[model samples]
Target: MNARLPERQASRALLIGSSRFSHEGLHDLPATVNNVQALADALTDPAMGGLDPSGCRVLTDPATPKQVGDAIDAVVNEALDTLVLYYAGHGVLSRHGELFLAVEITDPDPYRVHYSGVPMTWLRSALAESPADNRILILDCCFSGHAVEAMSGTASAVGGKLDIRGTYTLASAPAHETAVAPVGARFTAFTGELVKTLREGIPGCGPLLTLGDIYPALTRALVASALPRPQRLNTDLGDHVAMTRNPAYRPPSRSASKPRVVSQPHRSPTGPHRRASDEQDPKVAAEFHSAMLDVYRKAKKEAGYNAAYFLQMVQEVGGLEAARRLIRAGSVSSGFTALWEKGRLDLSVEAVVLQDRFAGLFTDEELDIARDRLAEYGYSSAQTS
Candidate 1:
């Protein structure tokens, strides 16, 4: 069945990660930090999940169960169309075999976990009570599949069977299997694939990615990687709820129209004016560059601002140096005018140069030049859409 993307303004997401644990028995999952940040970036990306930046909240190393509970409660109260809850880190079992999410202060002792960690029941209850039509829960932790049982009313630890009518639960591992977090990996095995799937998208999927579309992809990826298989539970057509735009979707090609020919002045080949075709026909070159820029802009708009490979290059070499390299490589040229003319100020080099994270990379004069160029194009920070 065809699935529809959620309304960005009416959706809310809560991402919780516990990276640092106080008890020595539980090793610190440094990868959890990257997991939360990358997931947040993917979800809020205009070309992907398209959630409002304000609507997605990240709570890392939460100090207490109350803190996590309160954050979940807040988003549950505000979300109207879709509510997404994601948690990564350690999952401990209570003495009664119930699942409890580890926090910074959570002890490894199963008896003490009930008081120190956030119980899965809290999330189950939240999902049961949420007013949103579509509720999604993603757990990346050890024995996360226990959540599936809890949601299905088979787990005795949850006290009584709970109704999960409009929810979809995706877990990283089976009840007995431990989720993998390779040493020095940027993210846990499960979440790394999840983020990659969200960013790169499934090639054969429809324009919008739904829970059902994502699950098989995730399973195939995990199986290919030799990782533990993930599990899920869906009810009331929860699997059809669209989560993000598919980055890999391609429209069918149509016949191309004839190119518009512009008249050019005759040039002397023997004089100093002799040069390349672009130099001879500046208008034609500008048009070519404009077309190339359009392709780049379309890619950025569909894949996401952070999903570009150039952004990674910028991150590795610094933004200004990356720009210099691109210029030297002749992969890019002065195309601000082209971008401005096309109402794609978001794709302007100035937008990247002036980003707060790239501060101190460009000189004040260079920044001023970028700002002036954008201003000339009637670009404003508030005009992003």
Candidate 2:
């Protein structure tokens, strides 16, 4: 272990999330990807965690052990003052009571566990031996508690009595429990609340919040959700370290600050009257809204994404009336296709305008689905700038 210096420490983070498993029995964890993204965003948000973007390394759906090992080595070698390593995926406890982090290609067979996943033993050793004074591990997976147990099991096995003197480990669930993602939510339960705490700030945490300060609230949320309580294990950290700088977050003012005086434009009474068809009934409009949302939901499910860009594009063309007609005609697909052919949906423009709005929301498969949708409407992601 390296000696702590008198000066301020540089910081680096490595975030890993594995969603797809090649093994037939192991189901994919779609929420892991979202958790990784949410954490990344929180860490990089200037008013929040404020870590330099270049110092953060992210790996998603990595199948090979080399990919994971190399990433871990790269970040650990940096020897920064602060190092945060986060993993969200399937975690298995072996027959020997060892913990293993599953990768995309990890076979579900119990006998093949050694070859399929990374051992928590190796990770613990790496972190313990790292020069960084502040080593933080955040695990969001089933059996995450096993990793912590393994870390403390045999200190000598992980580099001479396991020098975890300044390390902090946070696990989403207990050893025998499973970490759950809330229904219809984009992020896993643990991370969703964590991000909210980071972004919105916690009362009495002051202007700056530390991982230690946020732990209690996080524990409360998990318990309220009926989940296994999250655990935070620390080894001889003398003082709490600030994880993020919370801006002066406040509820928006309920009443408008100032009312603007507007001059009404004069209209010609003899001009053409508004079309009765354009003035859709409130009930019909509500149904149209619901139907439009259904179409978007279907598209998202098929595409495996939750980007708002799809809704924006649909709204750009025909508004609610087009959606009403499609639902009424019992032909959402073909109607959408017809709208595509009419050049009402500009794929390229929408992609550019909503790119940031939808960042980290679309997976490769979802983008492909969106591409297919565009093709049916005579457009392509490649063709769009």
**The CA-based lDDT of model 1 is what?**
0.74
- Poorly placed runs, candidate 1 (over 4 Å): 253-385
lDDT of 1 at 69: 90
Q: Please state every model's RMSD to the true fold in angstroms.
A: 18.1, 20.0
Count of steric clashes across candidates, in order: 0, 0
Weakest ten-residue segment in model 1 by summed lDDT: 327-336
* Candidate 1 lDDT, 239-328, residue by residue in tens: 778777889876433421122222343643222222232333545434434433544556466533322444455557644455434422
Measured against the true structure, the TM-scores of the candidates, in listed sequence, are 0.65, 0.60
lDDT of 2 by residue, 231-260 (tens): 666565412556777554343233422222
The lDDT leader among the candidates is 1
Which portions of model 2 miss their true places by more than 4 Å? Answer: 1-9, 154-160, 248-385
